[model samples]
Target: MHSDVPILLINLDRSKQRLQSATEQLNQWRLPFTRISAVDGKSLDENTVKRVFDEDNARCRYPYDLTIGEIGCYLSHVKCWQYIVDHKLDFAVILEDDLCLNADTPKVLDQLRKITTEWDYIKLASPYKFRPYHIVEQLTQSNPTISLVRYRQKIPSGTVAQVISYRGAQRLLQQRPPFFRPIDVDIQWQHELTLDTFGLLPYIADNADAPSEIQQLATRKALKQRRWVKLKELLRFKLKI
Candidate 1:
């Protein structure tokens, strides 16, 4: 693993427009990243409807066959895992294509690295939703985890840029369950179960209607419904923890 971390951008070949926009943004910001397309291994030309159904069915089998969403999540995790094994990198950052970073990203990342060194369970650095009452001003070690600064309002849940430690990456690869619904939520739940999940204040902004099916679905659901869902998830996660 190289000491220098490379940002992995998950994308699909069909989303040429969004991909191009993301590429342009990265160039404009001069951020280094590796782009990988998430295509169904069975057939690249599969129709959009079929791809959607396959993804909904979660028909992501091994030996190359993969659903659309599975392809994205799998490739993202695989690339990170392979990088860790090959280069022995301590950690790396991962992001979807729909978000942009703030000007202080480099400095924030530096702080993230320092926090990771002090905590084993610091799996992700979420740059979205600045919630109140979740702040951990300085690096203070909790019994099982290290706490970081959090915002004072409720943070909206979704994919943003995140930095993952080597241990976190290994945990992801090792803890594959039978069903992986909402891959982001699954990983977040896993972190919650371990009580090692940390949030970063002041999100990097998730572009509206930016080519994300999951986000669209979540948007359609009522805010109250979303809150209830989160509450239920928390209860379920508490049992696991």
Candidate 2:
């Protein structure tokens, strides 16, 4: 049962190579998708960044705009939502420029489509290492395992990818709040509020290769200091005291 759902690929205008790799990967997997680029025409100026960040509502707990790289990704997501509305697509799979799919993604997505009605949201087909306290157990023998957890709960594993239904898409559009520092972290934190978000543990674990830029930036030499900064921010946010 092939639905007329669209898959949106978020990419940056300058990162042509990464975009090409992502497209090739999608083609290799034979998944139906459309590519969208977030173009500012001009370079990443401080003014542009501030303008985007300032657009976010201040009422939300997290109200910060994205960096240049992430703004591109978010714009892609926004474009995907717009495409759904314009083309009348029910749902779409939103993939970032950095993520690569595992072999079992097609099968997992197939299964997800079968049980779409049963879920409020369909997260990535990969497994996520969420905080132990945040992991909820299944209460009923339902079709798929989607349990309730805290909205602010943190996940240990990095964000991979996921599929979203029309309803899920609508919810995201409605709550266009500034996410945590990063969009991925915000997605994971807000997953619980949505209907359901699942992870294909084995697939993600097997495909643990980082993007070229990410690998270069997050080198061992810089990792420790970066981690310390991130942890400090996390601790401050969690305590709130």
Candidate 3:
């Protein structure tokens, strides 16, 4: 029900079923959000695709040819960033359509807002656990909750949920279009983007059970690697979150 920090849901118009389900979940929580139509990579012009490919600089990036869905997802989030800049908002919570938010989501967001101005970005829904994150601060001792964490050179997880400020949007847009790497990887290049980023502990959110549009076109080999990465992330999940 907090409206101070605008909530934006990145969604593809084609994913009507998912959108409906996502909408229902959000509505049930009585949380307000804006749904931004995701950029459809399949319909992107050749030149548009070339530009993103030109900007690709991901370390251990996507192995196969970038799928239209992946590209679309990237463009869609960038679009949300642009919206933040355009509206001049204090910050915005960008949630992917397949997002799961529990009752504590509001509390987590409230604690996040306390430090929103201190950071350019904060990952809210991390699928797999990651480590070596320099803990910047802790908000709750009883629950072992972290207020902030430095990624240094690693990203915690997917773009399922995160909060980014207006300045963060500006820094992220510097990467420009035709970004070769995945959106998740692009935001972690702190040295490159100079984004003051952090991740929350015990992800208060996760994705809903649904097929991922981005992975629909992935090759068998790529899928294997993806699973391996997930397994590693799962280990992180067991870290007493």
Candidate 4:
């Protein structure tokens, strides 16, 4: 019942099933959320693409140009950041539709509000495989243990769940249009934006088993490639030329 910041849920309009599933999960935790209509890759217009995405930068930094789905996903998070700035919110917990929340999530979020330190961004989830983390300190001495952790080597993958402050949102937004990296990758490289990033230990949110829309779209496209394309790849690998 004690939440200092609004919870923003990013969901695509076409993903009714994901929205419903995420809704039920949040309700179970008694957490009210504002829905953010996720941007769909398939519907992106030329103007938006040119205005928001930087093809040259993307090719320079990433191995491949970002897919339509990646571009849409990046824009969706940008919308949430814009919302925080426009609405004048102090902070917000942004959740992707595929994230799963546990019982301790609400309490941890409450504890986050009480902390007086200069933390800007706090991650609430990580990939299934565990990674080495530097624990800065525990949130409280009370039950439902959770701690603030700093990443020494790698920032966790996926923007499935995270808490961002007004300042943090503004800093991220300052990067502005013509974004190159994927949203998650962009967050991992947050140092370039001068963000004090951290993650929560005993992560409260996890990725659900539901298939990823982006990956599915990528796979389908790959399957539809010409046979010659597959033959060329196979020949290159076998011949080792």
Tens digits of per-residue lDDT for model 4 on 1-241? 5755699999988888999999999898888999999888899999989999988866545544567888888888889999999999888999999878888887787777766667778888985556578878777777767688888755787878998889999998988567876787677666567888888767888888875663234633343334554465345434533
lDDT-based ranking, best first? 4, 3, 2, 1
lDDT of 3: 0.72
Candidate 2 local lDDT, 1-241, one digit each (tens) = 1534467766666778877777787777677777766543245476655654434332233333234545544445656666666676566776666776766555445544444234434345334444443433332243443333323345343433555666666666676533334445556544434545544222322223554332122322332244454565566557642
lDDT per residue as tens, model 3, 8-114:
98877788987887788878777788999888767889887776765343213444355667788888888899999999988898998887787677667767656
Please identify which of the two predictions, 2 or 4, would achieve the higher TM-score against the true structure: 4
Counted clashes in each candidate structure: 13, 7, 4, 0
Runs in model 4 deviating more than 4 A are 214-216, 219-241
User: TM-scores across all candidates?
Assistant: 0.62, 0.63, 0.81, 0.86
Show the lowest summed lDDT stretch of 10 residues, model 3.
55-64
Best by the lDDT measure: 4
The best-first sequence of candidates by TM-score reads: 4, 3, 2, 1
Quote the lDDT for 141 in model 4. 73
lDDT score of residue 154 within candidate 3 = 72
